[model samples]
Target chain A: MSSIISLKHLYKEYQLGDGSVFTALRDINLDIHEGEFSAIVGPSGSGKSTLMHMIGLLDKPSRGEIIINSRDVSTIDDNQTSTLRNSYVGFVFQQFNLLNKLTVQENILLPATYSRRNLDFDPIARSEMLMEKFGIISKKDSYPNRISGGQQQRVAVARALIMKPQLILADEPTGNLDHKTGNEIIDLFEELNKSEGITLIMVTHERELAERTRRQIRVLDGEVISDKKK
Target chain B: MKLQGVSTLFTSSFADFKRDKVRTALTSLGIMIGVLSVVLLIALGLGLKNYIQNQFESLGANLVMILPGSGFSGGRGPAGLAGGAEFDEKDVRSVEKVPNIKYVVPVYIHSSVITTADKEISGSIMGANEEIFSLINIDVQTGELWKKTDVEKKAKVAVLGNTLAQDLYGNPSDALGKTIRVGGMRIKVIGIANKIGNQERDGAAFIPYTTTFGSMNPKKTFFAIYLGIADKESVTTVKSEVEKTLLKRYDKDRFSVTEQSEILSTVDQIFGILNIFLVAIGSISLMVGGIGIMNIMYATVTERTREVGIRRALGATTRDILLQFLTESTMLSLFGGIVGLIVAWIIVLIVRNWFPVALNLFAVILAIGVSSGIGIFFGVFPAKKAADLSPMEAIRYE
Candidate 1:
């Protein structure tokens, strides 16, 4: 299978105020393939979230070659980078990250609102489809804070899928949910992967959650220690 | 961005305003006050100017005056209004002989106390010929005006101003045919002039210049010589002719001959300068208003840091974020400007009945344009700060 996103020799460093550098990601070579359900698994301070940010194009690497959907994005300007990220990738943060000011329906269509590209498909129609499919169409007009944590996660997932991105990057998507709610979210992701054949990359510190994925890339101290395909 | 996207952006941006209506209104208050003062001051200045123009136009356009010193340039003559040259019968006769010139009224003006049987009033006394009534638009409400024959005979017949008559006799018409004492002379009131709306002129009394010679004027010299021209077109010719005639008898520095329109324009020029000064004062308030908007924008940017991050993550470019905040600040300023303009318009309408104030197109345009400009000027720094935030860091900000 072709890779949806390939990161070559990625390095991320932060300069501390004390005139010292802290490396977040070091000498990373990874490829996330199409239609694969995978987890970037690590403990706290393992640089797993930073890796997800790099893949999501939310942050730039100090040194790397990033190819997203077969397009080299490392050298693009900010406007181009934003457009690429808008159309090519979807993000699901650990906190749900739903804007409380907007309704559920508005939230789902948020990605397409910022899309600068000429989209072939109608975004509103697809947002309704995602909401209907997720069984959250009844909550379309509800705000994020007014709904349950599970509902907000579904809305976030629907938002992630609305643009028809090549890759889904979820950083602890079920981190704020209760155990049963978390299981339901995992089930939702499992169904999206198996039924739609969409590329899914989840970042999780929980070992059990990582175990549910079809493949696991384990990392420690900014370096990948293992990559296993179950 | 697409049309729908732009709409969405505005909807979301304005939602912030909806949530904090009070903050928005308060933030724009500085701008509102700034715009209000500017518009109102301009309206007042315009009204005063219109009032002056109407008053001059009502007095008839062909009137000219000969004064002591430089006249409209400052002095009644070179000595100024305090102690200027006074014209006499000879000067009046010379000015009247100029072609196209009409009645030449020689005036000897003084302020003194006039006493009736039981009441006494201190006011201006205009000593002039019969033509003073028709030449200056003064109306006589009771009896008859003292005639030209009254000046020839040095008759002690007087015309009392409306307020002066009313104050002395409770009603102006009652004062008719009554005798009033002025400077040891008892003068009979032949007529009472109507209400003239001017403070000083409303409470005055008029006597023949011939009667005022020994008792008040003493030198038998006139304070000023006022001429009426037969045609508006000949006003300049009559003016120069009178000036030449006067120059032959008196030094050019000692007397001034000016058309009435020249005085009107000189007063108008003074008002123009005053308006400019008022505008400078108004602009200071506007600058302070701009700074007020900037301060609030900075706070808003800080408050919305997380939102900025989320927007960036959702594919908003740096420029998008910048434009969003910049537009918000500008909208705030424009909101103030529009409100101020409306408020000022309402005030002008209410004041129009009593005064001549008006709001012109330029003032309206300035309110909107300046407020928006202030918004943009003050908004840029905060917007730039918001746009410079890294999306990841912004999202992580508490």
Candidate 2:
């Protein structure tokens, strides 16, 4: 399969208030191929979230090259990087970061609204289809705060797919939901990756969830300790 | 950005305002008051100008007057120069000869006491010829005007003003044809001019120039000269020609010629300055309004930091964030401007009966423009702050 994302010697660092540097990711190298359903498993503060941030183009690595959709975008300007994020990458947060100000439908259509790239399909129609598929069509007019955690996450997932992004990155997408709802969300992710051939990259601490993916990469202290196919 | 995108952004921004009703109204209040003061003050100034213009128009349109003692010096005259160096018959005769000059009447003015049968009163006495009444277009209310033969004959006849006639005798008709003592001369009343509200004629009496100089006071000279031009448009030409003739006959330092147009323009200049000063005061309030918006927008930026992060993650460029916040603030101030206009209209309607209050379309447009401009000007710093936020950190903010 063709590679959708490739990272080379990536490093991330932060400066503390006392003028000392702390490394978050050290010389990390990895590749994610198209249509791959993968999971990065690690304990809290193990740099899994940092790696997701780097891959999502929401951040810049201190020293690294990142190729997204076969194009180098490690040092792109803020506008170009945002455009790439909008057109190529979609992210689901652990907190189900649906804007409370927007209704469910509006929240689902948020990505398409800010995208500079012309959408091939109508956003309203696409949002409707996704809401129907996710069983949240009845709550389409409700705000994020009014819906249940599972419903809000479903809206967020629909939002992530609005622009038909090539890659979906979830940083603990089911962390805030109950077990049943979490499994349901995983099933939705599995269906997307299997039926639609969309690449999926999820970060999780749950061993069972990580095992459910087709491939698992275990991170320990900002380094990949294991990579295994199911 | 595309039109649809901008429209969506505006809808979101407007929804935010709707969610915080009281805060939005309070934020817009500054702009409302600013625009209110501007519209009302400008309306008042224009109204006053219109009222004064109407008053000037009521007085004959073709009238021109001459003041004594130097046009350049404002007629204050040199120190120790008595009032004797005023306009005389020579100037009046020369003015009459100028083209477009229809009539010229020399006026000899003085304050005097008149003792009639049963009452004595203090009043002004104007010594002028028969042409003087027609020059000012004062209509005769009762009795006939003095004839030219009466002026040349130096007959001691008088024409009382409406109020003066009423004061002297209980009725205007009672004063006519009766002999009354004025300035120590027993003058018979010939006529009474129509009552034209409070004016020079309303409180004074008219006597022949021949009568004043020939009988009452031989030492009196013409106080001023009034020239009646045949047409109002010919005033400028007559003024210049009158000036040249008077300047050649009497030194330029001795007299000043003033057309009706000059006085009107001087009034216009004063009103113009006044309007500018009032508008500046109004602009200060508008500027304060703008600053108020800036302060609130700064607070809003702090409150919506997470939202900024969310929008950034959703593919909003820094420029989009900037424009969205900017549009919100602009709509805020523009809303205030519209409210201000409505308030000013209500106020004008309430107060219009007591005072002249004209609505100027230009001021309305300027108020709207100024409010919108203030929105953009003040909204920038906070919008920039929001746009410059780091997306990762913002999304991570609780």
Candidate 3:
């Protein structure tokens, strides 16, 4: 099967306030296959978040090529990046970045409104099914602030899946949840990977969460230290 | 995106506004006041102009006046000698012979005290020929007007205007045969003329021109001549003929003739300038309103930075971001303009009811257009700023 995502010799550098350059990621290479549930584990300032940013097409790498579904997106502008992200990738942020003002259903329907391609799924029915599956059905009309952190993250996941994107990039999606809720979120991701075959790329500091994924990579000082597949 | 999506965006924006009702109302209030001020100012200007125009129209269009000039040395009246020379009975007789000239009445005026048995009132005394009755419409409330024979014979018969009659005899009817003192001469009131509103001629006692010239002080040689044309259509021709006749009789360019319409046009020109001045004054307020909109929009950008980030993450393009902010600013201005229009209309109605002015529609439209333009022009910078925010940084913003 063709790889859903590929990165080669990726480098991301940031200029410090003192005008010295600090390398956030260096000469990184990675491939994520279809339906693969993978995690990038790292300490603070270890380049995992930077890598996730590049992978999600939210930030451009200083040097390298990134091919997602065989389309190279390394030098793309903001508009093209947004188009690609809307059509092919979905994001779940650590802060449960749901619009606090909108209800759960509205948050999920937001991506469809902005996508270049029409979303054929009935938003109401899709939201209903996702909420039912995630056991958040009763909270469909509730705002993000009214719900628990775990429920908010689940709603974020539901939003990410609404566009039927092939790739999901999650940045510490369960960092704010309790231990039980975090495990439950991971189990949901695993089930989505197994059943629906959506590739999952997550960045997390939790060793247990990283280990649960089928593939794991560890980074230190902006370079990869280990890569293993079970 | 489809139009349906745009409509959805509008609905969403409206919902958001509804969610924060107080802020929305406050923002709209700024716009409303701006619009209201512009509309009311323009309306008031128009009303004043209309009132002035109507006042001019009340003076008959075919009426013409001849003012005397002193000399033609430098188009300047000589010092110690008044600028305009005086016209005499000969000039009046010559103008009377002009073709299409219906009537020519020369007026001589002075301020004097007139007393009855119990009351004494000070007012203006005017001396005019019998033709003055035909030249100007004056309804006699009680008695007959002095005949042309009375003027020819230099008789002391007089007509009392409504105010003069009221002052001399207490009742307009009783003033008919009463005698009024004018500069030491007693003139018998033969008629009590009808009341004319707020005009210079409305409070005067009228007597024969010969009688006034004989009895009153003799140094004032100039007389104001009122020429009534036979045909309204011949007003221009009649005016020129009268001027030519007077010029021939006077044997110099010592007279100036003015048509009522010319005076009315001059008045209109003045009001037009006044309207422009008022509009300029109102524009300053509108500009302030524009700045208010810009200030509020800047605040909105800062407050909704996270919302902007969320929208960006959801795949909104920079253009979308720009449009959203622009739409918001424009909506604010449009709402303000509407509110202002309503307020202005109310003021116009009140003024129209209370005063003599007429309301016009052009000023209302101008107010609305100017206010909306202010909104769009001032809103662009903030919208661009909001649109240019870095999605990555914005999303990460706390």
Which candidate gets the maximum lDDT versus the true structure?
A: 1
lDDT by residue (tens digit), candidate 1, B275-375: 88877899899899899999999998888889888888888899889888888898899999999999999999999988889899988998999999999
CAPRI verdict on model 2? Answer: acceptable
Question: Which candidate ranks first by TM-score, i.e. highest?
Answer: 1
TM-score of chain A of each: 0.97, 0.97, 0.96
Model 2 chain B lDDT-worst window of ten: B72-81
Q: What CAPRI class is candidate 3?
A: acceptable
**Model 1 Cα shift for residue B359 (angstroms):** 2.6
The Cα error of candidate 2 at residue B343, in Å, is 2.3
User: Candidate 3: where are CA atoms >4 Å away?
Assistant: A135-137, B1-5, B68-82, B86-88, B107-223, B232-236, B248-255, B356-359
Give the whole-model CA lDDT for all candidates, comma-separated: 0.87, 0.85, 0.79
Query: Higher-TM-score candidate among 2 and 3?
Result: 3
* DockQ values of all predictions: 0.54, 0.43, 0.41
lDDT of 3 by residue, B1-398 (tens): 32226776676777677788787777777768766776677677767776666655655648887866632122455422254557777777777788887777887877888776677878887788887776667768889889889988989888888887776666789877777667677778888888865345568888888886654747535467878887889887887777677666663446667777776777777778988887788777788888888998999899888778877877888877888888778777887888788777777777776765444667667766876787778889999998898777788888
Point out the higher-scoring one by lDDT: 2 or 3: 2
Better of 1 and 3 by TM-score: 1
Question: Regarding DockQ, does 1 or 3 come out ahead?
Answer: 1
Candidate 2 similarity to native, TM-score: 0.81
